[model samples]
Target: MKLDVNALGTFYRMAREGAGLAAGRLTHMTEVETQVGVTKLNFMRGREIRRDFEDATEKVAVRVKLTGAIEGYSMVVFERENALRVVETLLADSDSETDIDVDAGEFDEMTQSAVTEVGHIMNSGFIDGWADVLETVIDVSTPEFVEGVTAEPFFGEVDETPDEDDLALLFQSSIETVGTEIGFSHYLFPKRESMAALLDRLRTSGGIEYDKLDGFDRMAERGAEEVAKTATTLTGIDTSVEIRRLNFVSLEAIPEQVADETLVGVAFEFDGMPSGYLLFLFDEESAHEIVDAMVPMEVDEDGFGEMGTSAIKELGNIMASGFLDGWANVLDTTIDHSTPEFIHDMGAAAVDPVIIQLGENQEFAFVFDTVVMADGREFDCEVYAIPDENDLERALNNLDVDRIEETPTTAEFQELENS
Candidate 1:
């Protein structure tokens, strides 16, 4: 079936509102603000899922099966660090941290109970809102707390169909609670037939219009220019950031673009309008060239070493700040970036952590691709940004809302995939 744009927009709005309710419930339970970021509806094919999760770090997943009407699944997925923070917040009065072993795949009973409650509230908030909006009934199974590294069959595998024709609605939300920001991708992995039914319901329901993404694309282009300017300044060479693409795409589809290639990845979290993640990608040659420029090394190096990585990290910090500064100036909001983390690995492994964390709450990520040129020599690079709904909306609001256009064509996504 061809994707229905109107139905998809309606679904996005419903999911966003539903996730907001879930965040509210969480805030009540933890006495901390549980802000819900924007939500995304991902159309995922089953065959490519393993590759999607292969190197993704494991997290604690609380899954609740759906039995009535919409037959599928709903769950809240959390990274280990956030999971630990949640457990600690839940047992603030008591010293559960001292008694429980904080293994990656294992949690103590008390921690399990707390995380389960979180799952329960999150799942209910999402499904209940969906049910009310669709005017349907959905019975939730008992919330199950399972801890693992990947969403494989052993963890929280919701997709039973493996064929490319089968589509799953992976609705995700960026959740902030207990002084931590984690993602909660609540998946509705209905069978093909069931998905058709849900889409039918959406078609009949009044659709909610979402803001267009073109403005952000333009903003990203400007940010890329700023980054290039920074590189030129630091290196005292003619440097430029050539924007290859600026688009939002499914998290799974992202790695497919740069997969198998060895890359230099630098990432950092930022605190701003809605909080976001910024990543810088570079090929080995590009990384070395940039590092050499940043540090002005005497000996030409073909391989990236510890010192080179540190120099690149510093450059990443500088470039990221320059890019974010443009956003801050345009949006008239303060954007603060954290320290950068550097990694040299295969494309999949390098991006897995950031992609997994951001993907947990939303299936789509805003990828800004750029190729750097230093002294007329081209270098491949990318800067991917995943901002929550709140920030996206705020950023869009700062622009001409009247210019919000229809959703970009599938051809645009295809370009990212094929790029």
Candidate 2:
């Protein structure tokens, strides 16, 4: 199937709209003020789902098979405490005389039933949103309850369906509550062919300008994700993208986000169809942490001295290469970046050169505002990926989103042999 950025954008809208609906339902049910929070996609393969659960915190999820508009499974996952808290709400709303303990550390039959209802509400909201957009009906099967520390409950049912490199779209949503606090995420695991067909349908229904902006948003998301992955690999620390944001503002407003104190950073300029400058800034403490993790020596340098600078510069090189390589893969082209320009000055100084160069012809720029942080506040790095607006459009115009697919393994071969 041939897919483009437009389809991906449309699917993003579906995820956003679905999250709003789910939030509204929760607000209505519990009578608490609830709102939708960050929504983004993660593309991962079948056999590897380590990104879904970084550590083995106990998780409780309700899974239900989906058919009609889309096929596969729709799951609502909650932390163990979060699930118990949800049961608290349902029991409060019920006037029955049945005895139930919310904090029992284990689920009873009645408690299980109550949590399943909550999961069903969440699943229905997302399905309704997709049905409205696609103008079709989606039928959901019986709810299945599973509780464990691993992702096996979710994937055990589908070992043969997804190939090794098949891309699965995982959407994580945070519903902000006012008085009571309950945090959970919704996951959709669809068959590859069904997902491809769904994207093709969305592609047939959107426009050009919107597609370009959506394409840029996706580019920023993936670039930030790569930075986190690279940081983890180099530092032996587990890091993830904390906050991902993309905004369009004037050149002057870009510097307003920088700090007043001195910062350690790396800057680079790239040349390609959608070429621009990339700047990564780390706070003094974060820079020190990276040096400690990567260098593993006690360097008594007051400022970013020679040895400290070299360590940071090397990290910057790998980060820049990964960020541009991600963009190149999406656009199916090559983007060459210049030598890393080390920055050991004030925060705003790192962005001034790019601002002066681009401010000449353009009034606004798309700034990828991302925060990549590690556990225990050990690593907190900020990414600023600013690409040329005109060049980005031209490159996206020639982009095919489905070009990123990898060949499937032997799932189909097994099916044929059985037949």
Candidate 3:
């Protein structure tokens, strides 16, 4: 989104006034240099935004390309003084320290006042007007919005767009991809007997409950569906979906970043989809046990195998495809998806923001804990959704498992018959 010019000016003005008040106390430095430096910084910040957002390298030319005329308003005297005090406090400990002996209480009060003033400025009608303009720009840039909403309804009215039917197909495709690529055959809907068995084993060994597993499974299915829908709308891909469960414990002993504790993930996927995979991962230890069980590797391995990265990527690809596909089906459109990316050792850190950005302008989050077990090892799983909790819940409730008939047991049975 483009920065609000008026808002930007207001921020700079407030900052400058604050600097000036603080500069009043400085006897050692030249006022001209400080003021010039502040102005330069403001100009540079604007230029930086333009360069990043608009790719305009001619800094001087871009600076003069104002969207609207600048207002001729003088700085508020009280606000200027407060701004100065704040600037003084910030630069107090700098190597090029100012000679201002600021009163701590007075500085705090003035700074608070200055902040309040800026807040008010942001909430003013001018900012609201700018926000409306920005929202329109964003909607125009996104093709789905343009196609889904008529220009009049899109620009003049905001209404809920009904869900489409293809969304479920996209989700199913993502699930199939993830299941095949990551060896997470248990991740698909209807809770395959093998997956149920795995869950039961984890619960029996780790004392986790069936309800928790059911909840996790439900959430994973829902996440896959929502992701599919989002991907379809955002990227025009109808087969990108992701299933994630967080804060899960691995049931088997394995390698860890620390000595023992870590997180686990389980994912699924589908076919004929863009970015063609759905994936989930667990803590290092949990992954190790899973890998051991899935492949013919010995159980004493210290680290994930060379196939681990590919496995993770395949999983991500499937999930992304599922979500995109689901979204496309719902929107009656198509979307393209990119190859999946995976990062292991993301322990206890803040969730990635890019994932959340997929659902633009919609406030969405996922909050749930699940467990993972393999070969008698246990781990915790936490889940996060792209938009809001309700969306995730709705997607899960609407998931259609019958759309994809291939399950681990059925596949195995087919293999036996073929043999």
In terms of TM-score, the best-performing candidate is 2
Q: Put down candidate 3 lDDT per residue, 158-190, tens digits, no spaces.
A: 221111210000000000111121000000011
Q: Which window of ten consecutive residues has the lowest lDDT sum in model 1?
A: 409-418
TM-score of each: 0.50, 0.62, 0.26
In model 1, what is the error at residue 143, expressed in angstroms?
A: 1.6
Which candidate should be chosen as best, given lDDT against the real structure? 2
What are the candidates' C-alpha RMSDs?
14.4, 9.2, 23.2
For candidate 2, give the lDDT of residue 21.
84
- In Å, residue 276's CA in model 2 sits off its true spot by 4.8
Candidate 2 ranges with C-alpha deviation above 4 Å: 50-55, 89-102, 157-163, 179-182, 204-269, 273-277, 287-334, 338-379, 383-419
lDDT measured at residue 257 in model 2 versus the true structure, 0 to 100: 66
Q: How well does candidate 1 score on lDDT at residue 399?
A: 59
Pairs clashing within candidate 1: 38-389, 58-149, 172-361, 173-361, 185-360
Give stretches of model 1 more than 4 Å off. Answer: 90-105, 154-164, 204-419
Taking all chains together, the TM-score of candidate 1 against the true structure is: 0.50
lDDT of 3 at 194: 28
Residue-level lDDT of model 1, residues 1-419, one tens digit each, is 33333456556666866887877887777676668764345545544333344446666677777766677766676766677776565446344354444554567676678778877888898888777767778888888877665546433354444344355556645666556666555566665566666667656323212223445545556577778778778766686555544444556656666648888888888888747878888888787777766675575555777778788888889988988886665455778999999888887776667778876666555555655665556455677766654456556566554433332212111112223
lDDT of candidate model 2 versus the reference = 0.70
